[model samples]
Target: MKKLLLVLAGLLLVGCQSGVELRHGYWVDLRHPAQGARPRIKVIVIHYTAEDFPTSLATLTDQQVSAHYLIPRQPPQRDGKGVIWQLVPEQDLAWHAGSSFWRGATRINDTSIGIELVNNGYRSTLTGREWQAFSPQQIASLSALVKEVAQRYGIRPENIVGHSDIAPQRKQDPGPRFPWQYLAQQGVGAWPDASRVQHFLAGQTPRARVPVEKIMDLLQRYGYPVTPEMTPGQQQTVIAAFQMHFRPADYRGLPDAETAAIAAALLEKYGAAE
Candidate 1:
């Protein structure tokens, strides 16, 4: 009897230490301490796995790239039910954001928690035929997860961004159809004020040659990785990414009146902090 009691106690202790009581899933190791050993999480990077639900699960589990949660698209039910899989603990670093930067900080994989939603991405189609949107059920689950994690980590609304927002040139996941404005309405991330942009643009002189350097500076300030050595093609890519996020109505990759106006307004609104 004494030996059985001791064995049970040991098992309980092990379970507690492993945090296995929290959820059900295969937890894989992808640990890397942040530089300078910061204890706080500064960003929440959102992504869409450009694969089906099952394939994403296998890749995330087998490959080195991992995220804190995998919000899969379950089949729609009459009662509208869905589930979110917690693939990793929030406290550990997930190998998702690679060579990324935001708000002057680099190596975002260290300071950010990544959450991947299973969607086929824009390579599918603009009609969203190839990709799947989050069901009402899935959104509820995802919203709850975002709220829980953001509150726990003291993450700001602006810090919660799509993977493409941080690494625009190399990525386009969680594409334009991701309903970012809807998320912002829920206090998740920043949404540009279209009226403010229009007002700012109205004030600009006609055919004005706004400083390209200043526009680049504003993008870099907002964490877009605009460097001095960037070639014209690289510049266009970065600009296109910015347009995708801010001026989705037009993304011609040209620094036209509208793009310049938006960039100017953004600088006016948020550039002072930098």
Candidate 2:
């Protein structure tokens, strides 16, 4: 009787462990009530895993780091359809934005929801290899998700940002390849008026002066953390990140006449909220 009881106990333990493992595989919910008053979810920051699907799944579920959702590269079904996996609940902070800031708000994970997509970023580039484009199905799913989250939390369209936007000095995931213009056309995020910016750039005089401090101030107003104490090199890099998102013509880190004009135009458009 004692031997039989021991065998049954071992079986039960194995079964429980298997169940936990299965739950950890994908779309596991990690919601826990926050210790303090609930802050508003005003931003929806997007990121790319910079890893394959299996690795992303493991990392997100390990309790060391997490995001609210993970969109798989390949469709979950054998029929080649894409799926979005819900990892952490929207109400919980998911260790996604580390030591980050936006528009004077620091430690963004407390006030934002993060969505991570599985992509290897630029580090996985191979010579002569074509980069993979975001699948149509994936984009459709992401659009729907963003609309739902934005409406649910009252998040502004401009608040949907890439991880690179918040941590320009330290990180660059969801690279230039990510479709910002498409999302803007769908009314999910902000996009500057390209024609007006171009027109302003064209009409600049050779002796015309640009207020560098004012441009930087506008960037700060638009939720970029630029300080007066930043070194020249740091300032250049931050400007480059800004251009990467908005201009995309060239991220040369130089605030030339054209760049300044574009920045000024953007300020005119979006700085009212600031």
Candidate 3:
């Protein structure tokens, strides 16, 4: 009897080890993974928390808003390297990128990983709004994290974008002070070719008028969500979002020749869909 009980226990243990039990009296063999499926992650969205690390941590972990990762303005060092926080697991969805659209994908939160940087955003001063710059150490850590994530998921350069780029009409978290060009240089995101931009410029001055309609088409082609029904002011917000990523020197939402040229250059290089 004792020998029979031991055998039964061993058989149950072997069955449990061999198959994953489902809640509804089903068992799945995970030894053979389905080849037809793909990684859910398609894009990487960067953001700036308008609060410090402690506040950002509390908000991301406890509040409705959350991100996969949180990068401090000044990261804590470990083994002579800066360390970042991972609030949410990569396999799970986070509540970031609220009501966002990118390329042809809507509800961007479903298919993208969010990385929030600890930044004060901007303070309204008597002169103007002063934007806080990200620290070098912070950017270094962020670049490493972004590169690893992009490579793991085989994400395209154009797919790595700022929060503002995904939701131009309502959001502007990673502002002008964010070093997009520098990050692009580190193979984490896209940057328009200067020569291509000049080709589109065609010797046109910066202030030269480019048809607003044409600019809108170029922006839409590059994956910015610009609808024909949007007001003129609303359209300018989209342009400003693009400028904030590619041309951080100024982002007044003007549809100048230079802005149009940059948009054209990006389309030529990246070849967006619709």
Q: How many backbone clashes does candidate 2 have?
A: 0
Model 3 stretches with alpha carbons more than 4 Å out? 1-36
lDDT of 2 by residue, 1-274 (tens): 9999999678657766655222444433234445895448988999988889999989999979999999876646545545688899888889999978886788999999999888777645456323356666667678878988998888876788888788989877677677888888987877878786777678776225466675576677777878889987888777777877776656656766666766666666766335
| Range of the 10 consecutive residues with the lowest summed lDDT in candidate 3 | 20-29
Candidate 1 residue runs with Cα over 4 Å from true position = 1-39, 75-82, 124-136, 203-211, 267-274
User: Of 1 and 3, which scores higher on lDDT?
Assistant: 3
Instruction: For candidate 3, list the clashing residue pairs, or say none.
Output: none
Candidate number with greatest TM-score: 3
Q: Could you give candidate 1's per-residue lDDT for residues 65-176 as a string of tens digits?
A: 8998888765334455456777877778789999786877788988888988877775446663343465566566677778778888778776887787788778876765
In model 3, the Cα lDDT at residue 52 comes to: 90
lDDT of 3 by residue, 126-189 (tens): 9999999999999999999999999999899999999999999889879999998998888879
Full-model lDDT, candidate 3:
0.91
lDDT of residue 172 for candidate 3: 89
TM-score of each: 0.74, 0.76, 0.89
Q: Rank order by TM-score, top first?
A: 3, 2, 1
Task: Return the clash pairs for model 2, or none.
Answer: none
